[model samples]
Target: MSAIRSATVSDLEPLSQLLDDYRRFYAQPSDPAAARAFLAQRLGAADSRLLVHAGQAGALSGFVQLYPVLSTVSLAPRWLLNDLYVHPEARGRGIGRALMQAAATLAREHGVPRLTLSTQTHNKAAQALYESLGWQRNDAFHGYTLTLD
Candidate 1:
């Protein structure tokens, strides 16, 4: 049976490989070293919460990363899910859903009233998966992001 738990610094290597594959799946350049450094910062600095699913010698089968944020008006804590990836070879094995379920549990434990995430407009497969997992479209809101150069 696979188990999910909070990710620590030691899981960086496997988590890095998974992140690299995830980015490549969406057409990003493959760079395992960059992935390693990025994961290192996230885990080392304690700026984000990353959960991993592993079994037998700690193979990272899947992962989800969340960034804690706050609501502007009420100042209530919320969690933004930044990344959710399941290794392609592990697809159809329910690892993705397991990660999400664990994420929700984490949010609850942290006293977060809600969890939020965004996906590319063209990613119908991921949207479907999210909807099936109880996420809904926010027709009343638009998401805008600014990139720093």
Candidate 2:
């Protein structure tokens, strides 16, 4: 298995492609330019951590992005595992698991108290993988979102 490392500006092109594909998976239209711009903004703001796995010939196989957040109840820092994606050709190769593990490791290194993520309820495969990694599903609170746009 290839090692997962922090994504840099040099990875923009491939990383943007991966992001585009990931968005498409969620029913979003293809927009490579927008993907690149969004990722570049995140990189520039330094508000998120992006970890990428390289496949054959140094191509990116997968990526995981984390955003720092605070847990008011605990008065401590936590991380939101915002985005995780593995190329279709790279699926079933453990890349996703590796990316997730790397994210956890990064959070630990930063002294984060916890990491949180959410997925579509129908995404059983991702839920299974996360569960296998010891990530527990929250049963105590209901999640709600409002879109202003």
Candidate 3:
């Protein structure tokens, strides 16, 4: 069967709750309030792209967030895939994969070259899924970040 459609602001609450659980699964702090706030911002942003999977019982199963960006040198539009989460209770239902496929489809429709995301080194499960999806491992460099303050 075909996957569902891209999500809109109306899905913010359900999407946020699912995100909280996804984070918690990775040992992150469980904070639904913070999750809601973050999701709300993405919902309100014009450049944000969300794809969701709704279960047969009408519950949200998964979601992926894509942010619009531009290449610094080439000046071409691109998409930064920020978050991908499948609810624990709804795992093995192909929600995550479907959402990812939907995200890629959207990016392609907009003429974007690729979809990019990251997982921690220890998150082998996620890495497996990404690899299974044919994502390449960028071994040429390491990821780094600096706190803004």
Candidate 4:
């Protein structure tokens, strides 16, 4: 086990692979090149933040990416935990839990009001982890997305 730390351009390759696997988990098509490019763009921009958990052998075990968004009602910055993934081989090693905790810690350190994320309703394991970590379900409002494409 290793500590979770902020990601950098140097971590691009492993990060992209992990991200690609994550997208695949959501039924996205395989596209490693696209994943690499996408992660590069995000890492280049200051718009998003990422934390990675590396294994004892220096392999990437899991990662969490956060995008900052404004909360108009609260008039404060909030973090959207847009992506979180632990490699299948790395599951149950506490990597997912560590990534989530690291993401929340980052938000708190930045003085952000909250950290938000959405996982498929079928993802009971992730939901359990979130609840165990003190993240409450947003029952007050419904979330909707309209794809332009």
- Total clashes, candidate 3? 0
Tens digit per residue, CA lDDT, model 3, 9-122:
788788778889988977899999998888788777766887888776666888888998888767788788888888777778777788777888888999998777888889
Locate the minimum summed-lDDT window of 10 residues in model 1.
Answer: 53-62
lDDT score of residue 135 within candidate 2: 98
Pairs with backbone N, CA or C atoms under 3 Å apart (clashes), candidate 3: none
User: Which parts of model 1 have CA positions greater than 4 angstroms off?
Assistant: none
Q: Mind giving the per-residue lDDT tens digits that candidate 1 earns over 16-82?
A: 9999999998899999999999998888799999999996667888999999999986679989998
Q: Which candidate do you rate higher for lDDT, 1 or 3?
A: 1
> Model 4, which residues run further than 4 Å from truth?
none
**Residues 21-92, candidate 4, lDDT per residue (tens digit)?**
999999999999999999999988867999999888878889999999999999999999999999998899
lDDT of 3: 0.81
Model 4 has a clash total of 0
Off by over 4 Å in 2: none
Preferred candidate (TM-score higher): 1 or 3: 1
* C-alpha lDDT of all candidate models, in order: 0.90, 0.95, 0.81, 0.91
Show model 3 residue runs off by greater than 4 Å.
Answer: 1-3
Per-residue lDDT of candidate 2, residues 1-149 (tens digit): 37789999999999999999999999999999999999999999999999999976788999999999999899999999999999989899899999999999999999997999999999999999999999999999999999997
What TM-score would candidate 1 get against the native? 0.93
